[model samples]
Target: MNDRLGRLRDTTINLAHGSGGRAMRELIEDVFVMAFDNPALAALEDQAVFPLADLVRHGDRLAFTTDSYVVDPLFFPGGDIGTLAVSGTVNDLAMSGAKPLFLSCGMVIEEGLAVDILRRVAASMQRVAIEAGVSIVTGDTKVVERGCADKLFVNTAGVGVVPAGVSISARRAQAGDVVIVNGFLGDHGTAILVARQQLALQSDIESDCAPLASLVAAMLDTREDIHCMRDATRGGVATVLNEFALSSGVAIRIHEAALPIREEVKGACEILGLDPLYLANEGKLVAVVPAHAAERVLAAMHAHPAGRHAGVIGEVVAQPAGIVVLHTGFGGQRIVDMLVGEQLPRIC
Candidate 1:
């Protein structure tokens, strides 16, 4: 029976897998259990159980997060809505410096949606959960009338535990603190635009829809002086930085050169008249650290596989509290304002 699905990557997935039969068992064993070979997951119980963590001294510090994915086309160049669902929820929990523990997935399917397509999406979601070291302990599935829903929609809720002394939030940025980003910006938005086929450009721009818990965990392990952390998802880096500036009562100036924008993404932005700085990113994050801990934190981030291209892009400075400006390469300064309207909708 297992030979039919032999080695996973080939069989793809069919609706039979979710029908409570041998196909169902094979799907879980071959993809979920196989990829995530851990005692915690191997139990195959209805729910996952684990200690919250000894460091959560104040109380049961559980960081909860949830996100819904209805990305058009469901499937894209680098990932599908399935991958986006898991990564988005997990990344949010991790942004609080918490280690992801368990997840619950809710799937809504249009009546006419292909079962095969649904299987493929489920398989992709399982793979993402395994890699993130979190479990889909519980889930719900519902079928919607045709044309009433957008192909398929996935909602994932995640919980994680934050270690002692690791407190991070949007308002944690402070004056004289350094702002560092995990990697290049706007890769996800540009990639989505290309995949949507609305615009044509010469390049293979892939979405950066990936899990970043490991990178965040590494940073926390090395330093606790980390003031804040946030994944720049829907609103892009510009919004993420602007929120901090207002919350911390400081102004920020980012060097255009220091901000990493892939040449392809930059080209795409120029071609479409889009600003990469204002575009969305799924796999990137911003961290605010005390000036003294900046180098150490950056070093730890750069050492991680996901943060290899980490950069100290800017810093928080005293100002009128709600301004974010950028220094352009052509010897000019520009006000990098937040989006006045929805420039790019359904981004995440």
Candidate 2:
């Protein structure tokens, strides 16, 4: 019995595990608990019960965010959709000055998907959630008919608490404020393109799908001068800047020279006729800070493991109109418009 079950443990999660029987308990203990060990999670309950603390005790503000991941190829250069789901949601709350505490995951698997692939995805999600200091409190799973669903799709919703004296948003940008990005641009998007488009480019571009909750907390701790924080996800920097501009009723002018475009990414974009500004990034962010605190903020960003390539990509301006303008490297400017057509569909 041990050997037969041991083989099951070594293999993938079968339908029996989702059947809510002994197979399910064995699967959870062998995989999920082993990968994400925590006292809260060890309870083995459907819903985790814990207290959300606050300094003032007046039900301090909290941040909640949810995102779905459907990256093709399942696995990519740097990370997979499972990890991307956890990181993406955690980073969203972090950007809002929140300390992520818990997460709920949902898996949509194709009926004929491989069990090993499912295990790999689940393990990746567990590892990332643990590393981010967040717990996967609960999750649901569903299997769709082969052609009706992709190989896999993961959705994650995170809950975080924001303490007093810390408020950040897209509407906080003001004139004379400096905009900073956590790292080089276009790596994640181009990496996916390389994988999905089957490009022959061989520069080893990697996806930057990493959790940034701790890094965000570090920035807020070191300085209170940060005006706003946002990750460069879909629609990329162009979209983020436009959001800030519209929310704050201000105009933003980005410096093309200061933009962080890696050599490999530049090469790939040139080859594919793509623009880096509109490219999506999973592990990068745009931080708007006062001009006076720019140096310190940039320094702090550089000190973090995830922010070594931080750059001051743009600035907030009062142009009597709310818009995002891009200054070309050739000394001209153009409106960085929101995406009209799908550039890369299903790119989470």
Best by lDDT: 2
Candidate 1 per-residue C-alpha lDDT over 1-348 given as tens digits, one digit per residue, 9 for 90 to 100: 223444434343345545656655565556555544565555656666765454255234789899998888788888999889889999999998888878877777666566567667767877888788887776655655667787778899998888777778777777788889989899889888887886777568888889999999889878658887888988799998988887877888889989898999988888888888888888899888988898888889889999999989988888857789898889889988887787677776
Winning candidate number (TM-score): 2
lDDT of 2 by residue, 107-203 (tens): 7767666767877877888888878988887776665665877778889999888867887878889999988998889888898998886567776
Ten-residue region with minimum lDDT total, candidate 2: 1-10
Q: How accurate is candidate 1 locally (lDDT)?
A: 0.79
Runs with alpha carbons beyond 4 Å of true place in candidate 1: 1-60
Instruction: List runs of model 2 lying over 4 Å from the truth.
Output: 1-30, 54-59
Alpha-carbon lDDT, every model:
0.79, 0.81
TM-score of each: 0.85, 0.91
Clashes of each: 0, 0
* RMSD value for candidate 2: 3.1
Show pairs that collide, candidate 2. Answer: none
